[model samples]
Target chain A: MIARNDRLSGFRARLTGAGLVVLVSASALLSTPGSLEGAQAAQEAPDGMALYEAGCASCHGSDGRGAAADRIAFDDPLPDLTDCSFASREPDADWIIVSKAGGPVRGFSDVMPAFAEAFDDDQLQAIMDHIRTFCTDRAWPRGELNLPRPLFTEKAYPEDEWVWTASANAEGPGAIVNELLYEKRFGSRNQVEIALPFGFAEDSSTPASSDGGPASDWGVGLGDIEIGYKRALLHNLRTIFSFGTEVKLPTGDSERGIGSAEFQIEPFLALGQILPGDAFVHLQAGGGLLARGHRESHGTAEHDEDVREAFFHAVLGRTFTSGEFGRSWSPMVEVLASTHLADGAQPQWDLVPQMQVTLNTRQHVMLNVGVRVPLTDADVRSTQFLVYFLWDWFDGGLFDGW
Target chain B: MAGRWGRGPFLPCALGVVAVGIVAAGAAESGAVTGRIVVAEGQVRFAGEPPAGAEIDMSADAYCRDRHDETLMDRPVRVGADGGLADVLVRIVNAPAASASSPAPEAEALLDQEDCLYTPRAVAVRAGQPLVIRNSDATLHNVRVVPDSNPGFNLGQPIQGIQSTRSFETPEIGIQVRCDIHGWMTASIHVLEHEFFDVTGEDGAFTLPTLPPGDYEIEAWHPTLGTVSERVSVAAGETPSLTLEFSSG
Candidate 1:
């Protein structure tokens, strides 16, 4: 045992000494005067095509398809620049940072060497311009068009996403509500969505039994299940418009007060406009119609007249980035107005203030939190706290980016 | 070990010198080509007869009606008196890879809309070159560009003299530009990567200059009439002149 322990200790010492030598040699090679001069001379050249061919074409092939696996020294797979589906979505600024500062700056592989000393900011931008030519197809919208998502207003751009939302009453009966939404994009402009809601709520109402005794208890049950289809009618760099329809099925227990026991159909039109200075406005207008009459707890039709409600929601927000191509923060305010279509119905107003933040280096996962405050009919309606976490599944796996 | 380090620094410098020398030589050997395009057998004709109702129905917007004295109909084909075709895009389809490295021209291509009509009808621009859109009409006109291989943009110009600038990152053959308000107004833009392109003038003449001596596939495209291509070769110090003829069936 003693002999084995001494051997292990000696092996560890030798490994440490070798590691130190390697580190010192790498530092010396990087700090050499010849390297510094070469970098300076590279900055003086204004031709981006020549620079890319000399520096990047070795690893990322001359056609930008990446070197073959057999030729690459690293195990990490290289990105394919010719695929517009992936290349068109990354902003030029992000590519420039990855090139000049190395991949680890964006939580990528360190095998990508830093060219900060070799290329100035302008030269780096020019190199990115040359890289942009790899993707010839431009039907795919640029990443700059992917604005920050608002809390209340749905975006017009179709997406493949999954979102989990939770809300709780802040000023009324103790209750917790959660919703899971899954959306899948089909064609260039169409998407299908499914949402399931379930919650636990305090039974605020009491029922009188036949024996003349009051019975009430907290309840946990499922809410209404909704299926929706949305289609983008027109889109451009500055604006996008879409129309969608949703059908809600009565799936919860009406006696437990977990959901509305009536079937409802809603159709809405949404519009997104890009404003100057990274600001944007989203507008949604829709009307809901009760497919069936309202039902009582005992499963009896109670209302003779149909219920129809119309609502208008608008959200205004602006995005600010942490760095040139880092996480983004958006602050938004939503104004909601709703009124019954029947006679003698008055409009009700509400306000929501929210903040959304990118939670991952790829900016594919995000979180939003907000407070919804009733403007009118305060006594009847209560304030609620809402939060949601969104995952853009098409970009990567949920656990891929950190 | 000393010899290896010394040679490493010298290798890159030697390569850089050779590359610069090659580029200078290629630039010096460049030549020019000139061409003229003419319509062979088709007569310029208008589309369907005028609508029975008030022509164009500009009454939807009072401003548009006031701007025009008579009815307006779109003219799809325009053939000059000398059998020359206007709005024909003549270009070298296959150019040398080195030619793509040439710097884009600094001037911006102009597309103007006056009296609720797009002027010039068609325009061609190089990729990475700016395109300036001007609205000279009195009423509101929203310019919407729809391209198959480029990012699309829509802008509203309510007043006169409104100018907007846009550029495409990639090459696309033709992009359609239209005014949503006046659905009848339309224009097309061709985006190319190289400088060997020109739109035929009133007399059906085009010139592609500073081309290296090589075999090239020259093509002439018309919006209504399809495309025609032919192969041509040029030798050093030779000024080649060619004629492209288009026929409407």
Candidate 2:
């Protein structure tokens, strides 16, 4: 009889626990609807201007010049959106991706926090629009016009840049050539460029009595110093055309087989056309005229008189992106043709298959590598491997954006 | 057992209950306003000789020349017999506050390249709405958009029946689009953040419906004649008709 009484007490305790649970659940259910309604009412679409002021103005500033250095929390300085030279070149899609996914999406710093939950795609786009207003000047060609650089064909767009190019023979005599080119834009459509070329090649050190001797030594010296001027005749959204003239000076030691020992002048026209699907074409045609009665060096000249040559080069390529605002890769094929102006001179042809890739987030630094294969006269003209590193100084400093 | 349940599963259940309440409260409440836009008469004026039949030089492309039956002229202005402007855009500049509660409408705008020319010389689209660009010509063409307040894009369409879809994120007054292959091919687009916009037809009339009752700033824009704006007040259950005039100096 005592055990039966203990069981009755246990049943009573269980009933009380069930009642407490029912009470708690009912209270929560009763209060939830009101709070949910209030939250929903607050979730209205945000005004673009107001959102910009609240979210971005703290760092970017009201005028988009960036906050004063003292007031910022981070060590890295902010970008100046008002500078059209830098801001106008980046496409909207890139800005949106950076803002929404944060800087790391384009290999930038982790300090830029992701706002994936704070703003929707449309909201981010609206922010981009507001940022675009900082750049009021429209005379500078937009960044979309800056197409990929081809391996052999020069682009028509005037640029402020520095490029280092290296070429090595794939076959035949051991040789290595390098050139440093600096281009500066003076006005809206005019640019001046200077090129310094140097190389090391196997030298034939035979005595003067010998007519054709085998190379027995290696010599390193300067090749040629070239200065050029280019002017853009026409530039539109789809096409850019330019004309240029260059003068090459004899600089290296002719006896070392490192220079041509001839003063030459070249005039050329270049054209760039934007095609569908991020594809493009570059065309360049020029003629080189050597000064009359120039002495041939190292018995390298095929003719005794001054020689003139005409050349044509064409490049076809397309750009592909890693992501919306990420790295870009361009694969191009260049066709090169050259022939001497002298009678009975045969035309020579070469093909270069290359790829150019953007290395930095700002897309100002790039690298291109290619192989130049001689299609005609392979025995005389050796195949070469070419590589170049280009930097667009107008975008940002070397260490920036990484 | 009670303490464990309260520390884990119970917390989530409570939050879910709150979320349910928030969604119920967020139901949309919207009211609409209706109006008709009309253009005033005798407003078409030009500084130079009226371009009645100025022919375009299509001699560069034989394919373009063969597609046209007669010589095509540059017609910047198209007016009906009633002096009604066909392509004038009418939109609400300052939308009412109720727009915050109304969801953006979904629609697509189309621009077509036919016979080496852009059809529908001008169009208006809502921001974030899809814009379809079509190439119907046999020759290659590229679409280049230049906008001051928005991101620009240059797209190439090499094949016929090629179509591309894009959307503008910001509201711009007018964006110019051109074909690089044929410099003469051009089109204009206006992007708005709100749906309260329309283009006038042959009758020079436009209607903006489903707008909430409030004061609004209305703007009528023309590609060449410029823009005109006026303030208007609307009341519930009432339809308002208004006329706008444009002049060339």
Worst 10 residues of 2 chain A by lDDT: A5-14
Q: How far does residue A308 in candidate 2 sit from its true spot (Å)?
A: 4.1
**Residue range B59-106, candidate 2, lDDT tens digits:** 656677787766666555445444455566788888755653455557
In candidate 2, how many clashes are counted? 6
The true-versus-predicted C-alpha distance at residue A312 of model 1, in Å, is 1.8
Worst 10 residues of 1 chain A by lDDT: A5-14
Please give the CA lDDT of all the candidate structures.
0.65, 0.63
lDDT of 1 by residue, A128-165 (tens): 77776776654454455566776566676677899887
Instruction: Give the winner by TM-score.
Output: 1
lDDT by residue for model 2 (A1-402), tens:
001101111000001122223322322322323232342233233565556664566557778898775444356678898887667666566677777766656656544544444567887777776776677654444455567887666677778888888787776656677778888887566789887777777654544445574535777888767788887775545566678888878775556555555577777777766677989877777667777545442244445455566666678899999866678899999877666666666666678899999999877899999987878767666678888899987766776666
TM-score for predicted model 2 compared with the true structure: 0.49
For B152-207, candidate 1 gives per-residue lDDT tens digits of 76655544786778788788776888765565677889998898898875556677
Which portions of model 1 show Cα errors greater than 4 Å? A1-55, A114-138, A207-216, A295-306, A323-326, B1-249
